[model samples]
Target: MRPAGKQPLQSLYFDYPLFEFRQPPELHGGDMQHPVVIAGAGPVGLTAALALAQQGVASVVVEKKDTVNDGSRAICVSRHSFETLQQLGAVAAFLDKALGWTRGRCYYRDQLIHRLEMPHSEDERFLPMYNIQQQYIEQFLIDKTADYPDLIELRWQSEVSELKNSADGVSLGINTPEGSYSLRGNYLLAADGARSTVRELLGLRLQGDNLPGNYVIADVRMAHEFPTERRSFFESSGNPDATVLVHRQPDNIWRVDWQILPGDDPDDAVRENNVRERVAAILAMIGHEGEWELEWWSIYTANTLCLDNYRHGRVLFIGDSGHIVPIFGVRGLNNGIADAVNAAWKLACVLKRLAPASLLDSYSPERRGATIDVLRNAGKSSRFMTPPTRGYALMRKAVLELALTQEFTRPFADPRQVQPYNYEDSPLTTPEAGAGEFTSGPAPGAPLHNCRLDEDDYLLDHIGHSFTVLYFSIEARPSSELAALFAQLYQLDPACCILRITGAADQVNEDDVLVDASGRISRAYDAIAGTVYLVRPDRYVAGRWKSANPEEILAALRRALGGSKP
Candidate 1:
């Protein structure tokens, strides 16, 4: 076998199984089988599996958990992720149980200081943010993939004990109930979560710091006389200082979280009497004397950490396995799910021999950059939730006070701060020089945008199957040669779409807009006349030119398609 540090292909193929030349049933006239093995069965893992399945790539998912956890961990699904779910054919199931939330209020000292409503339409690419449990999300994905033969096989109760990667592929030692078995695949994905055993086996370390505080979360049912439409944030007024976040579930149950006291024992914090007292205290603060019934309560520490590397050879990490941020911004789960979507299609391309092995390197730089931003936002939100110093407290109060006015609320209402993070310097991004002030050009290492192309249309449907070449020109028609070449390429491969623009266009404006879905075309592509942009499947700019040159554009396409240099 080749040494571990060598390039992926040499190492992977050095000691992998050799396939015999034979005709197979699935490949009646083909010669190769799809190659990808994913670890874990969580939302991230399932998302990766479903994305691959949607692309006709065969994969397998192994999970240690036997069944889904009936917990209310993740609640808010962002507009971008909502669009992704729709693509996976799981949006309908999620909408069935999700509660649409269009407004949020921030309270300081029992006074409503800021209230903002979402600026969105019902028929937009994605609806306003929805509040749904993670369990339901997983169930929907699992049900959606039930009939896809090309999809993954859910190996419940299967845990991966060890993983080894070489130049050609990956081999995993999975510990099953029956016995330990070795499985091989072209690439292995580690969506196994924060305490991932797969990450440890690969000798990769999670690099980041844990915050200096913790919070207590409880799932309880309360019969109260409060507005069910509004989510309540209550500041502490009693001993054992706390802030309570209360919101109603679709099942008529209330999800409540009480910020824990410093140096409090979590095990003892959830005792029957302690939970009762906490509920009673919250009720009293809200001026209600109703019956508060406790269902489940747990104390958790809100720690923020990120992995130094998301890829270790053929085994790539995604989701909590790569990064863990505080729950204040509700981005941890969302970030993980987004990572799955990013890595899934890329892995499929590599396995299908459509993209080069070096493409995997882009995964870490892209997702980690986004995760770092998530941590930063979560840190900021945590400070707002639990300000550390007097100065910070004063600033928080001022922002809230300003939010009370319409003039100040308009900026804060955008919620762009909590949107998906952008990638700024990834290797996958092509350099765009001398193209200024246009939105359609590519940024070398930037993350995708989270907003829709337009108010009425969704960006997800437009970007499907292959890379997109968005040409924005003020000229009446596209360059004939460029248009013909793109049309020929699309006719040869219907998986891609080449859209031409001139003068008046809807959805995007000039700027650096490159993302999988929901990005401003004008922002990234420089909506200037006669400009052509080449976007990759994951929605990053691969290359761009002032005007279309078929030869130069074809070379860039060849590079993106994993072809060797001329």
Candidate 2:
């Protein structure tokens, strides 16, 4: 572990020649011509590759690990992230093996403090969160990538030892089992884990500290009688030196974690018989004791750290390389997945010449801002889990006890506190006053609602293909001349897809401004009588306007297309 400071980089030295003598093979197909190369076969890298392939851009992924490790880490995926995966065609495989949880509870000592029933809508797609192992996500991504041919070459056992970047692209020196070889890519994405070799080589600085807390994580099969559908947390009894958390997986397996004192030897505490004793103690605490089998056990130190920047010229970082938050909120993996989705499309646009290079600049500010928000939220959740002092613990307990009441729980049910994020300051967002608000006239930065089009009941599924524009009324529709101009623009820009939703259509009345498939339009979007909304590829509202002014719409499109003159 290196200290937190600017350290001089060490030069690379090899005992043998860097590469065995061989002629460089000629690259094949437009896929191989991609400028970006991702190093790591983790979920973030695989998601990025999948996103790029879906957009018709190629990428190469190199992994030192030969196979995906079936460790049950990163077990929770958010609704937004699940939708993003579905867009890449990887969610079906994940859903086949995932566990859906619509309820969560918090316990303090012998009292149930907080209980939350997940949101349910007439639309089933937005129901519950999914829980699946991180490895499953990686495997699903790898399987779906077959459609892209050789766009993503997963060279197992290939390790990147050195990296060099210039104004053009990145040059990587990789050491493989056979021999060493050099790879040149227009861009490099570092989705490697926390101790990233790419970040170290680039001399990038991680911004936070490794907070003082260590815990032991164990995956075991317990033959005891306990609720398998709920997550349980137990506070320390009389002694603040210990705490326990248990999560039950869909496969009937249990994941148990116990907090360790500062001087505890984690390895010694995880002995076979010792593990059984700990399980027995926990079961006894809950008044159940039975036979149990241990599958795997390990210790980890929790830290809240983030990189200062997500991009440096052609080399970009995602996943743990960019930020790592406390696990209480289950935000780390979900945040990384979001980063991959955001970067993959921009990289594809740049490679295909559909959008200018300036589009890549949005990755850092948007993701970094989101990362900061995750840190703050995770920090709050962590404090709720492990209060700093006796007074804090008492306060937390009181709050949770109060939250058990219906009146208090109703306010806490607002998912917006967890789901809302802004890309308003992003370089890609158009500059308009009150762009961040949900106004009627075409203003940039309006979020996408789960809405529908005319004669269609499934708008969420249809809107996933590409960027979309929806008109709320027939009067808001662009004139024939403007429609023709937009048709040309859509022809030139393969990333933007347009759809119209109007009151003149079935199930809609003239009084209805914006009617979703389910006919539920809240005050969130204001539902103006005659207005149009422009959504980005990632589904954030980019621009909205009341008038069908083709020139204003074209100007907004130009700004979104990377600051080009319309």
Candidate 3:
């Protein structure tokens, strides 16, 4: 992937405006009622608020802190995440400041073992992933909230102290700098990070595997010419029987994660001196001898955990509050972003009365399924990066040895990265009649690819935040049934839209149409004339029909909105 529209940027934390703690009128006196009350202002909560705002839904964001995150929390934003940000109106700032990369190299004992290239093509707008600090991720989201002043309100230094869930709504007791307050919402979103107060109040517990291997992640600054790429070192002379990972970030900073020997205290590992020593050893091993300064450091053990359910009455959990997967493939925040997107759209539909309450029930299964899928892949990467047992360590050593010499073994060194999960079995999706099994292009429950629809924007810009009927009609004129189908969508979802795409300009009519002059959208969908695709508000294909039938589309729309097809 190639970087585009590169511009110099200052520190995201320093350059962006700091949010101030707004004094709320004693909510205990019943001063405010938010339709949606979100519990956290981190990346997940901020993204959830923005997603709600984009869908014309109002929300209140409660942050325990007055500023964005101060560390390089999550540095890799996947391509699908970029699309979601685009839908939520926060991608331009991210692209301007992030380091986009597609290639990674794996080394076993100083010998190149494998070179991995993620799926990237010139046709795509954003790179497969971008490396930016979590501070920027939160800052960009905060900045975008300004565009929807009426829709999103951020409450800084406000912590959720208590939560009461009922059939009608959820009431929250909040703690602020000024005084204690109370608030109520029709629905509550729990995005308060891994130590979620909402989850505690709901009495929900996460269950998953916990590995004993520990790792120390440090962010250091230095001037060097190494391009942006992920490099993993296995059992190097600098750290025998341990693995170190090097990832480049913006602002001349790099993220270094290395395994800590058993019985090493995590407190001692994050000490500046200990971190500097480890950085020096890895830097020397990687052939760098620059004067380096340690910026920040943290430590953690490998654990994969998730709640039994994501939704509880009027309260819903999102992001890390709902699940925690090993960070082997950068699935942590990326999956959290997916959570924000998924929950936001469904909440919008139910809030707008466009779907049944059962629609929101699918959020748990679909996203939890996604979390489990991530665990399955990330578990593999974790076992390789930090073997949990002696037998696993021996197997990894043997695998590394084979990868060093055998080309066939190199693919095992892949980090897999983050991919949008297929929701073929989602209750909200029509059962796939072999559509999800397709290898050529998108299947039902697959992600919609961005393609140049005209000289100005991509096809994805036309989809999202509402049900979309993408009817592939090559002719300039629309048929009566197509027009009827378009009309029906408005009745079903007021936010819904129909993108009438055609390769011929002469066939375009008064209904605003998109000209797929390059035929990329058609190729990406493998569509023909009269083919129709139903896209959910979250940009996943709900169903595809060889022909546009209004009744069939209406039935599919019902199923997508959590109603059984009649």
Q: Give the TM-score of candidate 2.
A: 0.83
Off by over 4 Å in 2: 1-34, 222-230, 236-241, 284-291, 388-420, 431-447, 451-457, 474-478, 503-525, 528-530, 564-566
Off by over 4 Å in 1: 1-34, 117-123, 222-234, 238-240, 287-292, 387-417, 431-433, 437-459, 471-480, 487-494, 500-533, 540-552, 555-566
Order of models, best lDDT first: 3, 2, 1
Q: 256, model 2: CA deviation in Å?
A: 2.0
Q: Which candidate is the best by lDDT?
A: 3
Off by over 4 Å in 3: 1-18, 432-439, 453-457, 507-511
Residues 1-566, model 2: lDDT tens digits = 11123122211110111222222342221223346789888889999988887787778787777667436677777777877776777777877877776776555464565555666555446445776666566767777888787676666677889999889888887776667777889999999978899998998878885665666666666655554334445463422346577667646557777776656776777666666667666656655456555555566666778998899999889889888777766677888888887888778877888778887887898899988988777666555555555775677556545655645643232222245467776666666534444544324654465533334343556564456766554555567866785686586566566655543435454332344543344233465554556677777766676544566666666676677644
Question: How many angstroms is residue 196 displaced in model 3 relative to the true structure, after the best TM-score fit?
Answer: 0.8
TM-score of 1: 0.79
lDDT of 3: 0.83
- Writing each residue's lDDT as its tens digit, candidate 3 over 1-566 gives 00123122233223545567777665436466678999998899989898888888999988888777767868999999998888877888998999999999999988899998999876688889899999888888888889999999899889888888999898898898788888888899999988898998888899988867788888778887888999888888667668898999999988889998777787787776677788898888988887876667677777889998999988888999998888888898999989988999899889989898888999999999999999899899888888878898898888889987788778878998989999888977765444433344567788887876555577887774688888888766577876776777788898787877787766544455777777877788777788788898788989887666678778889899999766
Relative to the true structure, how large is the alpha-carbon lDDT of every model?
0.65, 0.66, 0.83
lDDT (C-alpha) at residue 163 in model 1: 75
**Decoy 3 TM-score against native:** 0.94
Q: Which candidate has the top score in TM-score?
A: 3
lDDT of 2 at 1: 10
